[model samples]
Target: MKKLALLLAFPLVCYGLTIDEAVEKAVENNLQIKQQEMEIEKSRYQLEQDKNLFMPEFFMDFSYTTMKDTPYTKLPAGSLPFPLSFKQTNKDFRFFDFGINYYIFTGFARIEKIKISKLDIKANRLMLQEQVNTVSAKTKKAYLDVLMARAVVDVYRKQLEAVQKHLERVKEFYKQGLVARIEILQTKVKLSEIQRNLRKAEGELKIAKAVLQNVMNVNESLEVEPVKISLPDTLNIEELYTRALSNRSVIYSLKERVKQINSLEKIELSQFYPKVAAQLKYFYTDQYPYLDPKENYALVLGLQWKFQGAAPYYGYLKRKTENSKLRLRLQEIKNDIKLEVKAAYERFLTAKANLNVAESSLAEAEEYYRMVVEQFKNQLASTTDVLDAESMLTSARKGREISYYQLLKAYVDLEKAVGGSLKDEK
Candidate 1:
């Protein structure tokens, strides 16, 4: 229980990073990840707004009109006199109206729109998850790159030391009149080459650290130490493909899109039915010597129907057409996802094979270099033989590092293809 407590508090501890810590930092500080989080929040608020569609809306309005002269209404007198007259309007007047409008029926359009808004929220969340996964994968790749570059530097450093020693021994032989001057010149050339390679390796290591620092959203230089890459004895492609279909964010987002489209189809179906709304209003008007002055209120029911336009039908038909297209697009995406997973898996297997070969070659080269060194100490092997063996051994060591890094990179790609974390298996 104590250990678990420490584990739960691990994020509070600051020190050198592991892969998981690097990923956590990236998710917390990366701009793209934060942007997606904001997008999810925006969608959540929009969903809340959509839910308010069923509630009444309040409005207040005012109007004023001006005329050149006072007006009067003239009514025809049937038998008593020539005409009847009454004051009807003021030259200038103003009125105020306040009301609450509520919908009674919308042919289920409001409900369907709300459902679609909910799906949009889900889609935004899935997009955020997708961004998280992308950042995680890229962080791991950068971490591995730092390690690989550092290893290359180490390899070149060791080779430079070995060649420097050989150059000194060659000069000593020339002084003793045992080797020719040309041999010394050759050893100097080899030493210069190793020095150049070491410098280039150092430069590469710095660049790799910069890339890693950028990915982590930090400004400090890094001396990164990461977990060793491991591969399983066997993998089942079918199992991985199945998990990807269920777990991938793109697929799930698309599924939500299909739901939204279906909801829109239902919304368009409402075009055939009348839209009904209820309203309550209160009004106040003051016009001197033109009409009676009193407070007025009313409750009204209204019905609206459209029968002439083809717009709603066209909208519904468009969604229906896209429905078939969406399904087809989803199937295409699945096939593409399967192909990506399979290709990455194949590369992983190839990298593993290459690593095996490189390891075996390193072992053989080490033994050969040792034998050659012994022979040179006994004056039985020529300087050329020793130089060749050392070069071959360094080459093999560099090759092994390259192969190891490639294998790790390939594993990362495979995990990304599946849109999940595969390091747990290791």
Candidate 2:
């Protein structure tokens, strides 16, 4: 009853990491993902700034000035009814001015700037999505690697234990003069080999765990849950290609970039035209001369035309060239995505076939080992025969473990190529 109480108190602690959880943690913690998120936020702020350009800008000015001599206008004696000389302004004066300046016309340059900023925000968001997909794929592969390494270690440990038991049996047989000394030596040699392999497998498992930790951006040890192997029912290559073209984040980001370039070209073209602006100012001064008012208000309309030696035309051409280059790059990316989808699909199929073969070989190897062990117990099989059978069984188990995880990793690659989960396609 005490044992039962203790069992209930402790229960069974199962520390494990699910594939989804690993991917979630990696996306949440990856530095690249965080950087991309910051870029998106910056782009949003830029968009806001661009939109504000359409609103009026308010400004104020205050100044005080002193002159060495009083300002005056004089005329020659015959030019006016009398010689005109006066203090046109005070020796010291202060003024305060406030005004608003608004662009009445910008040749549509401001409108295009806003459009480009909006496109920048959209492009950055798509880039963030791409980064997330990349991180998730890496995490899935790392998780699978840990699982495979652990399975291989288990296989080696079991083989080592079996070899140890066989060595003891061989020793007893040698003592009874049923087997030669050479047989004992042979068993010991095989035992040493299995021990060495076990050590190597343990080392690999540690390395695999370290890799998984790095991918998850964590410092703790990892215990990954066993994954079930389930092959997709069917793969339609054409559908996959179609989905990849439509769904990939890189493609969308490129398209947004092309749109941004087009907007930039429009802005450059706008520079060839004149700009019109309106200003409203209210002024106050402490001292005024004869014609100067103490307080006044004015409304001004201004037009600015600049011809900077074909600079505007060349700038427009530059944007046009950039737009063309982006279009070509976009096409290149589309082709690359198609190729990736095709390659990933092929690998998944190959892994599935390899896994099936591994499973069949494992079953046959297990049966062969069992038969050889029984024959050895009856003294009808040599020590070499039993050892060879065990080795074959170990190899088969390792092959199966590798094939199983390779299939899982291949599926993850395919999902990343398609830019989403395969389950979503169904």
Candidate 3:
């Protein structure tokens, strides 16, 4: 009984998840990231297959045959005695062959194909990185939302408590005939409003937690640690644009696409040239026909060229046009990135200023509320005045909470626009 009582007396502890930890969990578990990784693996395998085009291919063949009649040469009726005939081949025979085939030249088509495959692999990897960055930014924003909701709930709870305490004071004053009956009624009304708002805030907090859990792809409930509002001390717009251009995976992926297009163009150009191949073979047969060797080895070289109604030239032209389009697209992406960085930077600055204003307003509201409460106790202020002061204070607290989190979110957006963490910047 004593052990049971001691166990019941202890409080359950839950560790809080940090923003970085949440982002890591989200990235590690996201289905899109997993799919992108698979795509990269597939491209790597394709690269291996392309490289194998340069290596020799080994082959073997076997056959057994039964003829309906023996293969023979018959003498002409007037030239032969007694219509004689000579057997040329056995009725039943077996044959076997072994060979190696190699491409001596394919106008460098194989080399270009290999280069395109390698570029594909690099492009897929960059896409994966881009996906990771997107997920990380989303997770951070979700985490901040949870923190903001929790803060709002706390503010509402405190407001509820204050209103309840004031109601009791108002009731006491009414009993002593120091205040009017309407004072108690007004106080009751304020207390009820706070209770309703508190409930709403609580519900919002639950939703925020659920959203965070869903983003992290976790089954268990999450408790996130409160984060301090810390803005970067300096931000250079030009430097940020430079970092975004250099570090963004999308840009790099596009560049890889350009390289792949170049390789493809080369491959298409090679199609106009002839292909040369060599084959070496060893053969054996159970029966030999006239002038046929029972077993032998041979080396052969072959060349092939086809004219396909100007198709090769047209294909080369197509690839060249596509290459030009890709380069233009790359330039367009760079321009968009610069614009994104600029917008995010401006938002961060706005949020920062809003936070500063909210901080000052909150302090002033707190002081004003305290003074109004004191005045009410001395009968110098009415219940309406007290309620008004409390309302202003509640709004101020809520504003401060919202502003702080918005600033954090804005900073996260800026980091996302920069394509990496700003803290890593020198």
The candidate that wins on lDDT is: 3
Model 2 alpha-carbon drift over 4 Å, by segment? 1-14, 71-84, 286-288, 424-426
Each candidate: what lDDT?
A: 0.86, 0.90, 0.91
Q: List the candidates' TM-scores in order.
A: 0.91, 0.91, 0.91
The residue-by-residue lDDT of candidate 1 on 1-426, one tens digit each, is 999999999967656678788889888989998888888888888889988999999999999988898888788988657888877866788889999999999999999988988899898889888888888889998998888888988998898888788788878877888778987788788888888998999999898879888988988655666586566777788988987887789888888989999999988878888999999999877655645655689999999987568888898999999987998998998999999999999999999999999999999999999999888767788878988999999999999999999898898888888998665542
**Model 2, span 1-426: residue lDDT tens:** 999888987745657889888989999999889899999899888989988999999999999988888777677678777787777678888889999999999999999998888898899999999999999999999999999999999999889889889989998988898999999899888888888988998999899889988888899767899877465689899999999998899999999999999988888888889999999999998655665568899999999988688898899999999999999999999999999999999999999999999999999999999999999989999999999999999999999999999999999999999998887454
- Model 3 lDDT tens row, 186-263: 888888888899899999999999988888889887899987745678899999999999999999999999999888
How far off is model 1, as Cα RMSD? Answer: 5.4
The whole-model C-alpha lDDT of candidate 2 against the native structure comes to: 0.90
**Model 1, residue 181: what's the lDDT?**
91
What is the Cα-based lDDT of residue 425 in candidate 3? 57
- Model 3, position 193, has a per-residue lDDT of 86
Shift in Å, residue 104, candidate 1: 1.4
- RMSD per candidate (Å) reads 5.4, 3.2, 2.8
After aligning candidate 2 to the native by TM-score, how far in Å is the CA of 42 from where it should be?
Answer: 0.6
- State candidate 3's TM-score: 0.91
Report clash pairs, candidate 1: none
Clashes of each: 0, 0, 0
Task: Locate the minimum summed-lDDT window of 10 residues in model 1.
Answer: 286-295
Give per-residue lDDT, candidate 3, residue 162.
88
